[model samples]
Target: MKKRNLFLFYIVVILFFTGCVSLKDVSVYKNEEISEYKYALINSTESLTSNVGTTINGVYVSEGKTVNPRDIISGYLMKRGFIIITEISDDIKDKTLIVNYGESGRRNILFGYTTEVTLQFISAGTKNLVCSSTAEGIGDREADDIKKAITRALEAVFEE
Candidate 1:
């Protein structure tokens, strides 16, 4: 019994450290002046396509706030001198930045939890991608994994 418990403890520690890879990658385009535009938050398309089995320390994790990628990205942009506007007007299309983001994740019994988010910055008028960033994070709990994915996505976009 004691050996079984010790084995379980080792597994948890390994999972925790390996999960903290830090997701530090980003790509920023300089053609368009991102800092000079007024940005609008576009609601992220999110879903939990499947949750057949999610566990922490071998116990199922199924309760937590459903976080949106838009919120995290916008909140981060707010601090970077961007005015987060609700409505993107045609008049400001040249100056408005449309943020499009999405996230997907799955809970694996063997690997714990993993999440990935793709964030895009588009110029409304040109319909061209100004900049884009992708971030990935992991956690034992589903909610933490999701949150980390979003926060890291934002960090990568700004890269600050």
Candidate 2:
């Protein structure tokens, strides 16, 4: 019995330490040329609502809040000295950078939650793909994991 308890304790410890935010994969198709664009627009394709929760007595109770990935992307761009534009005007399109973002996540039975964030940067004027990147993170909570993934993804996209 003592040996069994010790093994169980070790398992718990491993899970606790392993359940953390991390970048899984990062792919940069283009270099840091995105710095040339002064204005940016974030287009998020992720679902508005996240269904990360637990089932309680046959009903699903959500523990994670519905967070818009666009907000996070916007903040990152602003911090990078890029002006965020709400609307894309024809005149500004030539100097504007368009960001397309998407996210997906799943819960692990033994570990925690895993979140993946994908980003694509396009030049509004030329309508060309400037850069793209992907990042993944794991955490005990859904919201935190998603945020971590987004941050990592942005870093990968900007190469900063």
Candidate 3:
């Protein structure tokens, strides 16, 4: 009986660990019109799905205070030689790096699970696609996932 209980506990632990990490699919594309862009702006974040969860956890609905793409990208891109900007100024309008969210993917409920954040990088002046990628995390809430996604996005953009 004790052995059975121990086995069940281990199984539960494994399940939790496996479910915690996000599942991500990323694709990147850039246009030839890429030029000097000094400031990065987060244009929008659209949510397609409502908060989801089974009775096991409870609903993980997001409040407006949850998370924003601007905050995430800005936090990471700061060190990577990108000037993060909140609002567009006349001087920075032409040279802005626009980060726009693509699709509102799934949102896991209960215990603050993962959400898929799809974003496109575009040049403000040319309106050319710089790159697009999808990353998974508790994108609406988890600060850590946001940071990781930004790091991955920047690496994809600047590295290649």
What TM-score, over all chains together, does every model reach?
Answer: 0.68, 0.73, 0.58
Over all chains combined, what TM-score does candidate 2 have?
0.73
Candidate 3, position 53, lDDT:
41
Model 1 residue 50 CA deviation (Å) reads 11
The better candidate by lDDT, 2 or 3, is 2
**How do the residues 1-160 of candidate 2 rate in per-residue lDDT, one tens digit apiece?**
9999999999889867685435456666884488789999887546445456788899988854566788888888899899998889998998898898876445454455577777888999989988887777665556676777788888876665
Model 2 residue 11 CA deviation (Å) reads 6.6
Q: Which ten residues in a row have the lowest lDDT in candidate 3?
A: 46-55
Candidate 3 lDDT (Cα, 0 to 1):
0.62
- Top candidate, metric TM-score: 2
Q: Write candidate 3's Cα lDDT for 1-160 as tens digits.
A: 9999999999999779666655565556666433477788877553222343444357564433344556556666676667777787777778887888643465555445664556777877667777676766544445445545655665666663
Ranking by lDDT: 2, 1, 3
Instruction: Give residue 69's lDDT in candidate 1 (0 to 100).
Output: 55
Query: How do all the candidates rank in terms of TM-score, highest first?
Result: 2, 1, 3
